[model samples]
Target: MSTKEFIKNQVEKFSSHITPEEFADLTEAENSLIILEVPSKDYTLTEIARIIESNNAHVMSLSVLPVSDGSTLLISIKLDISDLTPVLRSFERFNYNVIYYYMKEGEINDIQRERLQELLFYLNM
Candidate 1:
């Protein structure tokens, strides 16, 4: 199977045991996502929306946590499943710190938390 099929299958499997809240978080919208670890700034929201648009995604919701030096932003994006990797590549090229997880997979999963921790350990806490 193609990678997209593999990913969709994996997400489907992961969703099976998820709680209602988690399920809502993951599949509320077909192209929905949660992005975390973005720098805090007055224009951060506008910038994030722009980024999503540039990647051919749409912003649905956003949450923010402020730290001493920067703010972490959680953005919900609506995008095509096939566009995930390319969108991620754009984020990388722009130096936008990003952490993404489906709501279901991210809801209190030790494995998911550990993996994300490993990936973002160096990011400012």
Candidate 2:
């Protein structure tokens, strides 16, 4: 059992799933992850936290890493709640550059899908 625990993971595999280091607050089902990118000089942690808290969520953990682009930073935040729609909208409204975000897969709305399919079919004709 212990031998299997020390498994070797390829770099590619990490892209598709969260690894141990990023599994801090994500270990709980309720927490969700959001990664935002911004010019290091333009962003303030207080501003980011205020935006999230305004949307009624709390930050569980945060990690900031300087991106290869010397002037940019990647801010990874783990929020206490899983629903990110409201938070995402607030970020958009504030013109924040959100690079990536993830939560559990949401259920697809069949009605919306059907409508889109009909629209595409009509457009093709």
lDDT of each: 0.52, 0.67
Model 1 residue-pair collision total? 1
Top-scoring candidate (TM-score): 2
Candidate 1 lDDT over residue span 6-106, tens digit each: 33444454446764346555564544344545554543666666766786766554544444444433333434332355456677787776565553222
lDDT score for residue 3 of model 1: 30
Off by over 4 Å in 1: 1-30, 68-83, 103-125
On lDDT, the leading prediction is 2
Candidate 2 per-residue C-alpha lDDT over 84-116 given as tens digits, one digit per residue, 9 for 90 to 100: 778888999998987667654322245568899
Clashing residue pairs in candidate 2 (N, C-alpha, C atoms within 3 angstroms)? none
Q: After superposition, how far is residue 103 of candidate 1 from its true place, in Å?
A: 9.5
Candidate 2 TM-score to native: 0.65
